[model samples]
Target: MDMGIEINTRFGRLGINTTDALIDIKSRMPVVEARSKPPRVRIDTQHVQVSIDQKQCFAEVGLKPADVFAKEMAQKSRSKGLKAIADIARKGDTLARVDKNPNAIPALAKGVMGKRLDYTVAALPRSRPRVSFSGGVDINWDMGYVQLRAATSRPEITATRAGVDVYILQKAAVDIKYTRDGFDTTI
Candidate 1:
């Protein structure tokens, strides 16, 4: 009971007539678009300095130069890793061109948005702690939250970096039909 129209073009010769009936089609469909957030890095120093209203005297506590170096290395690793991921995601999105090539959509979903985006950590120096990007979708889309964070059970500082996200919108479509005298179309 499936029916369709066949139109001929330079690619090949074809024919369409009343026997080949056009079936019900979409007036509109959802198109997906993506926006990316900039990569980020963070550090938490567990010390707070207090100051008086008028004046305050500063005091020094024990310092660990190695810890400072480690922090810098960790931040650098995270920032660079995220930046690389964002670039890859951008490339994948561009290649997908979801509006034009539907076939590329699945590749974009699996390669850029999945664990592949988190590959930078494997090459980072040992001083940096591992980070992971976990994804989730919500039935109520507005309530969804996506983020990146440390991969440890007990992280001193919880970090969140926003990555690219895709959403959909409906668009109008055109319908075509033929009459005995001529053709009619509506948008």
Candidate 2:
């Protein structure tokens, strides 16, 4: 007696799906600003001034005596004897005298005869005129300055991860057959 057996098999298959990663980035640059101011200046000035005084000079020139005779007469008027004689003559002598003799010597009186005679003498002034002068100047200044400002922003980024999916499309299978004396026995 002879026995035989035969078998058939089929393998399973799988399917897969994949996805790629993605990234996005955004950036911003820094900014700067500056400002400046100019300096300021100011100036002040006063003009020169002058003043002159000539009152004393003019009075000295106008009141000076003309000659030595007038100066001597002015000095004799202040003597005590001359002043007493003048007083006595004014009080007692009122008659006029006539000179009939030609041989009488001329009399010289040592005194001022004028009723209006100035005795006070003015002092002489300096050769140069009196002068005064004044002047001034002032200056002011202000310093300059500068201002600066700066700003910056952070960067932004976005990202995505990769992913994969798998699934079975078919399952494994097997078939068996037996034969006895060349005749099929099992199916």
Candidate 3:
């Protein structure tokens, strides 16, 4: 009989692992905003004014007493002189005849007629009516105006981006095994 030996063996294979790359992006849209304030205004005004004066008018128009009496006396004296002259002319009398007449000449003024005569006259006081006027006025004025103001504001925006990452999920492994076979003889 012939004897024989056999051997069995197995080899493990290497394993590979892979993962896909990842990327992330974040963004914000551009924004536009506007704001405004209403205009502010103010105004001012002044009233009209006036003034008048009349003192001077009163002083000029007023009248006093003694002036009236003097005017009356002058008119009376003129009339008396005219009457005496007319009587003498109507009678056809000469100055010599008048001197001779006892009734015509007064004892107190007999010699004084041919000479200068002087006399003093007195008058009474009284008020008279008169017309007068005066007037004056003053005026003032002021102008008005307005004031105004305004304001405004601007807009804002933001954006962001993230990085990519890659990693393995499992590791590769290998295993080896061997077995031997032999023939046996018995006594």
> What are the per-residue Cα lDDT tens digits for candidate 3 across 73-112?
6787888888768756745454557767766556335544
| Sliding window of 10 residues with minimal summed lDDT for model 1 | 53-62
> In terms of TM-score, how similar is model 1 to the real structure?
0.19
RMSD of each: 56.9, 12.4, 15.0
Reference-based lDDT, residue 93, model 1: 72
Give Cα distance to truth, residue 74, candidate 1, Å: 5.0
* Count of clashing residue pairs in every prediction: 0, 0, 0
For lDDT, the strongest prediction is 2
Please give the CA lDDT of all the candidate structures: 0.49, 0.68, 0.48
Better of 2 and 3 by lDDT: 2
lDDT of 1 at 138: 28
**Residue by residue across 1-187, what tens digits does model 1's lDDT show?**
2345544333333343333333443333334444446544444343444433211111112233666658977999999999999878887776867778766766666765667334333422224333434433323223334455433333244444444443334434445543254445543
Candidate ranking under TM-score, highest first, comes to: 2, 3, 1
